[model samples]
Target: MPALPRARLLVAATAAAVGLGLATPAHAAPETIVREEARTAEVVAEAMALAEQLAERQQTLAVLNRRADARDRALIGYRAVLSRYGYDGDPDTARAVLPLASYDLSAGFGLTGPLWEAEHGGQDFSAYAGEPLVAVADGVVTEVADAGPYGLRTILTLSDGTEVWYCHQTDATVVVGQEVAIADVIGSVGSTGNSTGPHLHLEVRPAAGDPVDPMDWMRAQGLDP
Candidate 1:
């Protein structure tokens, strides 16, 4: 037998078996058969409605999954921005301020140790974790991200070409290319990089020169760290 004709014949046979043997008694009346056919049609219609409802639910779930994926990618991009530095535009004109509100000086610049490698490049302000770390000047944010030995840190380039490094931070509130005023909350004090305790490691580099004593530099700017 031909495949299409064979399959059609099988369908007709199964339909006959269902209508005669499964659905109707041998002596069923014509009116009873008409009522049974109407009931069967209603069942088929209900099944189609249920399938449409299921399809709608699946489509809604697909949309929600796409939204979740977008949110997750956005979060990842935000974190990546926090973990590194990049140059934005030219620096702006801004003066310097103390990096922290109030804190004891735990370490000063040029402190030497075998562990320190060369001289310590920055000043350490001993403050509790979560203490606010502010920008020292109004300038462009050149970097905001994780760094070696400094942990989480941010660097701002002053208008006069001075670079200020604020290290051992817990989080950065700004991104590269952001302009910040003096004392703007840039980050939180932390013990992230190579540190014995929670503190702010501050460095000053005038004209991108070698790291200078931040305390002396701050004093020249009339702000004590």
Candidate 2:
């Protein structure tokens, strides 16, 4: 009989260790290992099915990312083109896959427009009063801490590599790794840290930790400061 392929031989041996009794290579008949190959094939097939399932999930994520990019463009009014990799231009406005609601999102509270504001890569915003706050997007609560002028803050990281930080909060809504939704309350606005008054301080950060102008993003969603 032809010799067994080295790859198949290794797989059969491992399968035997996991289930069937393993035999020494000194066994007389090559048929002994060939029988084990069929069992190993079943394992490989199961792995393929699992991979297919993961691929489908990736496709869903791609759609969501596309929508996010469109939302960004609308808010900032920038004609910046985006790759179709993660956009899903869903037109439904009923509820956001992740959304933000009224919770004292006031204006005049940053560097550019407000009396006091924070800086990110040379960008600024208006400063204003801080108060009760909540989640702006659906995601896991990744951070809850203080940033001198920003006050108590909570960061919610969405599945699509977008991070939302609710700053100038009086208190935090959730701890690290906690799952939160767009409709759920997370915290309140306050001047606990480095803030001046009681207004919500919001920032949108990339997964790599770069902060962008959330003003442009919020406007894209048709929200006013």
Candidate 3:
């Protein structure tokens, strides 16, 4: 090829490329292509927003699941306490457990002693000093103060509104308004107040009545006392 003809051929090819860039298809319009691209971008934005919303919902469900697990554990603990008191999962026929792990009656409920005002208002369980004294049933500690003849005493109010008195404690482990499970340690045995020796003086009083014989109450709870 000659030099002038080769240069002319290169110019013609470049012009044809430019014309191809400017040409439009017979069926497709420029405005339609632009509109299609805008719609695709909008769809992508909507999908991203929906993904974020799903992630937030999953986080909320995780928190709710944790709370429900904690609530279930608390319910199991409460039911175990009830079962120990001889409740066959029935609220109408629940029995009570003994207050102490082991004991011997040192003095009867009606025994006369130097500190007796009329008669003994409670039973004396002969236990060594510092023996753990527990609540007989599930109850709330209503009082943890010293009474006149019962030193270092603790009063537990039962679920049926019965009040139980634990007297002559060397030390009290519970406070007022504290909830106690069945057989939960509330105090230790000691000869406090007008006691003759180291023993636990227990009293049971109904919600609307005076102190009853603790021996009979213990018997009712299937305990020999």
* Model 3 per-residue lDDT tens digits across residues 87-131: 435544555776775577777777776768778888888886666
Single out the weakest 10-residue window by summed lDDT for candidate 2: 78-87
Q: What is the C-alpha lDDT of each candidate?
A: 0.66, 0.49, 0.67
In candidate 3, the residue pairs with backbone N, CA or C atoms under 3 Å apart (3 or more residues apart, or in different chains) clash, namely: none
Which residue segments of model 2 deviate by more than 4 Å?
1-131, 222-225
In model 3, the worst 10-residue window by lDDT is 1-10
Which candidate, 2 or 3, would have the higher TM-score against the true structure?
Answer: 3
Q: Residue by residue across 1-225, what tens digits does model 1's lDDT show?
A: 001123322443345446544455557799998887676555545554554454345335434543553465477662332221111222242345567655888888899987587899988889866666666767899998777677777899999999999886756778999998765667667665566677888989999899999889877865544
Clash numbers, per candidate: 4, 46, 0
Runs in model 1 deviating more than 4 A are 1-94
Candidate 3: global Cα-lDDT?
Answer: 0.67
Q: How much is the lDDT of residue 113 in candidate 1?
A: 87
The digit string of per-residue lDDT tens for model 2 on 42-161 reads: 665664455445334433443454355447657753112111111234333312222232243345323453454433321223222222234554689878876555556677887777
Q: What is the TM-score of each candidate against the true structure?
A: 0.57, 0.46, 0.58
Which pairs of residues collide in candidate 1? 83-145, 83-146, 84-145, 151-193
Q: Give the lDDT of residue 67 in candidate 2.
A: 55
Question: Model 1 — TM-score against the truth?
Answer: 0.57
